[model samples]
Target: MANGTTYKTCTCRDEKGKRLGANCPKLRRPSRGGDRWSSTHGKWAYQLELPPHADGTRRNPLRRTGFDTQEEAEAELDHARGLLALDEDAHVKRRITDLILAVLKNTKKLPDTEEVRRKARTHQDLNRQITVAEWLEEFLARKRRIEATTRNGYAAHVRIYLTPYLGDIRLDRLRVSDVAGMFDAIEEFNDVIAIERASGDPERIKKVRYRRPVGASSMHRIRATLRHALNIAIKQDRLRDFNPAAVVELPAVTRPKPVIWTDERVTRWRADYNARTDLARRARARVDVIGCYISTPRPSPVMVWTPAQTSTFLTRAERHRLHLLYRLITLRGLRRGEAVGLRWQDVNFAGNTIGVHWQITQLGWQPVQGKPKTDASDRVIAVDAETMRLLKKHRANQAKERLAAGDAWADSGFAFTDELGRPLHPQIATDQFYWIAFEAGLPPVRLHDLRHGAASLMLAAGVEMKIVQETLGHVSSTFTRDTYTSVYPEVAAAAAESTAALLATPSPSVLSHGRRKPSSARRFRH
Candidate 1:
């Protein structure tokens, strides 16, 4: 058939043989051949002109909807015919415009290209898209410049807790719910070992995995770090919400009561240490004479000290060091760090006071001249006469060693030092104190407990709370009271005694009840 366009007319005759007004309908198609209408079939159809192929030709047919009412159908057909008359390019453009308008109507708000670009730039400048890993890095960087002990603690937490659990999360997307879930997971892990032991099931191994949920104090530290990091993020506009750690309920942890050595225990341990120090001094004196003779070029005198003798001498010296640490703890009540970091300059023999100006940290002793834990901690403590004597003797011994070592000495100017005159590591001193306690057959206690012991002794001896507060460098008298009141047996006994006296005293009514008859007789006699 020839390629042609088609027009259709819907006709139904009236009684006069003319078409009725509603019976006839009109439709039209473009002259450029694409599809044609069939009168016999009463439908619109299309023919595809396929290119010649080696195997076979393909034909595609078009279909249209038919309606029983000719006028209604013809009206619809005319609309379609008008759409087909437009060029393909113009039709596509019109379709795209319709789609965009429909989308705008549905969305109600869509930023323009420039507005989106501006927002992107702002986000870039603020770096508001930082991930959890990036935030952790920044947090660690800030922490590294702090005290070594603090830095080590923070690093340990990041390594053990935060990074493994949350490193991948984007800081901005972190939510309270997510943190809660993590906490639950942590608790599960902490209980896993017990669960696994009870069940003994391989499949439940994950349930039994050992994970330690942080304690209340540790949780406080973690929250501090997280709050600090998130606050930084907020300042940079990277985060809009505060840290979830702040709102999470932390497990309560009661501080353990400080255990202090009794005076009897202190005396015994001190006596043992002093005996060891005297023995060490005698051995060192012998070694000094022998060392001088051995260094001489001419053969003057040969005196051999056996390995056992040398070992005995070394053991005595070791014991002496242990004693010194014990005296530092029990007598002065110095913290392990403060004792280890003490220098000659920090001690004033004339003033009989010790300056707590530095602390021996994990990284070595660091000067903290600005402030101590409180104003009270910064105060000068008057030394006891006995403690002053021991300190002066120790200083003389140190001076002798300094002269002997001469140029080879490290010259750290520390009051307590190794043979090389280098500052003592606080941890080492702490370990030695424990050893000394073991050797002295005394109960084990932390170096800090020494301070507590001092406070407890003062309280037991009727020292005023304010004096104890100032001596310990506590911020307030209340702090001293809280610490020492519980240990003061005398205070408790006195309170109980007063209460008993109040109960034992008879009321005025009881005393007067039996004397009424005698009073009237006595008045009549008078």
Candidate 2:
């Protein structure tokens, strides 16, 4: 085991006023024949020689002062020796010594013996201490396989929320309360955002660029990112023993049910929309139009069109160049990106299947072609005969356009494209859908809602939930039931009648008769 010595020291001066340390006259022992040393003149100190560096460089001795008694100094020296004794390897001993030196330099105290032992036993680096901020940055750098959009989301959580709250904390020292407290602060800031937005003062809103408060769902996502990063730290890098973010509590995310645009709901929504538009018009006339905004929350976040409304929108869009795109999306449940990213070669008229192998995602305003959103999303959807016929017609039109453009045609091979043969931007498709619905006098429904409508239609037609899940590329049937099963009015009515018929009682007229009569009779041959 390592050993050390304890002695007295002081900051006294000689006759020339030169400072004295160990050479102080008050530190002398009475047995040396000098006047008895003053009891209150100096403090006890200790010094221990440490092992050399891994490369054999000489190391300075570990020395500390300011102990009230010799026993106090000696006790700390024993603690340091105990830490060095935990590991037998020379390199480990050197690392423990370094740990002690660092604690003394930064805190004016000895290293925790248990903490040192843990680090040594785990084979973790003792020379480098990582903070939460540093580890998050490193984690993001190693996430190479994730999508750019996903990476951007993780970066936002780290930069805007995580780093600002928990960045300075040591990675190992993070506690569940620390993570929870960060969320609490976020909720408080959310109140500020709401107050600013409700104030209706343009300058106040402009000062806080993110006018919307972070919702409970967004909070869940932030926690997910933090938890995932910490999991990797513990499982992959051995950087932490536990993830504080794992148990941190937040509000549950409640997804709104998809509501069909029934006549009653449509009338209510139209009245609200028209009122908001009128307010905005008047506000624009009174003030600078650039800064004026009239806001109204939608009835529901996810809304789908009824079959009649869907037919009306399709009829209005029938003459448009991308009519087939809208029709396919409505009937086949294709996402906006998937519809725009469809390639001609992936469509098989003979096989009656369309391969969903690629998508064009928007990174800000720029569009980039990439693999489908998930592994399940990359699937082959079977098409009906009528859809195949429309595909042929679309191809013929595309050929004529290609001939007209001649050398100017880009020949991008996308199933839906501009006359010049370039791929369609996803936003343009969304815009066209909006205008077509407006012209058709239909209540508003997002382009993605067409996919929801298709799922509802399938369920109304008595398709199995498992089939719907697979057709929509959902990870699970439970998710499909929870999110995509919007009840149609007719389906709901049929279910109610079927359930009531189970307990139906005989009528008074039938009870008065001698026997029950069959509602339907057929003659039988003898």
Candidate 3:
């Protein structure tokens, strides 16, 4: 319609096998309605001259053959002309032309005109063609101010899950189905991993690189990362109109609730652990219980020590060098990183509060000193009087050690330190906590569970949840309630009684107990 022609052409060959093309005699033969060309000779085709390149170079004509009739070719040519006419600006027309040419060249089809028109209307750069992998890499590269640990997580998600599954997909062409398929594949692979791990063959187990299958929580994170990247592509560059990852459905993740290691639970744990040990010994299998080989599964992934267990651990660790560190975390709910990163300057003995301004997180076993994990994480925790006294004693002990070491001491200002006064690595503190709990003949709980235990103690002591939330530096009370409200038995029982009391009707015995008894003279008169 703009400037195009439809004609018939064929693969008619000459005696020498050369293509006859437009010069074939059959094409010029008279057919119907006085037309010069034969109708049945060849297939119909259309050709149009697109605008020149921005550099003013002459461009090739857009051509398509193999239509069965001239009307089909003409209709397509008209459609192309309509797309070209949507924008009159030379630059936009050139972009539309290039889009059509590229799509035709690669896919043997014209670009979707409506999509191109929408992009043009939105002023999006139609020339940029990036794949999912490329955009993900670029997105990660642009996140300069993100925390190292968060960046590392993004990188791992991209490398392990995203790029491998969705890398080659054109960003604009990605669909919800494509994103959904990736998750489905991951779940299927989880089944494979489970099967391999359960198979006693060591070779099969070794093939399972990640022994733990990708969980619902990790899947959620992967989806989040993908969605974030796509959103940037849409909002920042107008590169895409929709985020397929956003609409994709995944299994819901249930946060593991913390369970208290009460006497009953601890007794059961010890019996199960001992039975496993005995079984392994009788079978002559060298069991690495700590490594989780031939060991008892925990009652819950998150387990908190009861007050008695906490006291027992404290008493056992009193002679240890890091006793104060363990006590601070147990009583104050300090994260392992925060406790490890504590400096002498952060402790205010007069105020009985320790400020949490710094943390040393582990990046694959390497210590990385940084600010607190979150803004809320930077807070001040009030220390109890007894714990404060222990802190002073620990300081005095450290001073004696420093005097004894003299030139050998490193003079590090950290509250918890190694023999040379170097800052304690987070892993080191965890190892010490684990060994101490083991030697104390207590059921195993992770070092971080000490913080959970502290929360339980505060709640059981009738401390307000908002206060506990602030003490633990949680961003919101709701998160604190959801996570730490798996309280001890006593706290749960108290809550139950309180709730029941709201609707309770006094029993006959309670009513009688409140009534005044009749005097002897009044009873005789009656």
The candidate maximizing lDDT is 3
Q: For candidate 2, write residues 233-338 as lDDT tens digits.
A: 7875444454667655455577567888778888886787677567756644432111111112345656788888888888899879999999888988887778
Q: For model 1, what is the error of residue 31's alpha carbon versus the real structure, in angstroms, after optimal superposition?
A: 99
Please give me the total number of clashing residue pairs in predicted model 2.
Answer: 0
Model 1 score (lDDT): 0.52
Which candidate has the highest TM-score of all?
3
What TM-score would you give candidate 2 relative to the actual structure? 0.48
Model 3: residues >4 Å from true position, as ranges?
A: 1-253, 283-289, 292-295, 504-526
RMSD of each: 35.2, 25.2, 25.2
Pairs clashing within candidate 2? none
Model 2, position 408, has a per-residue lDDT of: 98
The TM-score of candidate 1 is 0.39
Q: After superposition, how far is residue 268 of candidate 3 from its true place, in Å?
A: 2.7
Q: What lDDT tens digits, residue by residue, belong to model 1 across residues 17-97?
A: 985432243343335785444344333322222222233443332122345444554454443333323324443323422
**Predicted structure 2: lDDT:** 0.76
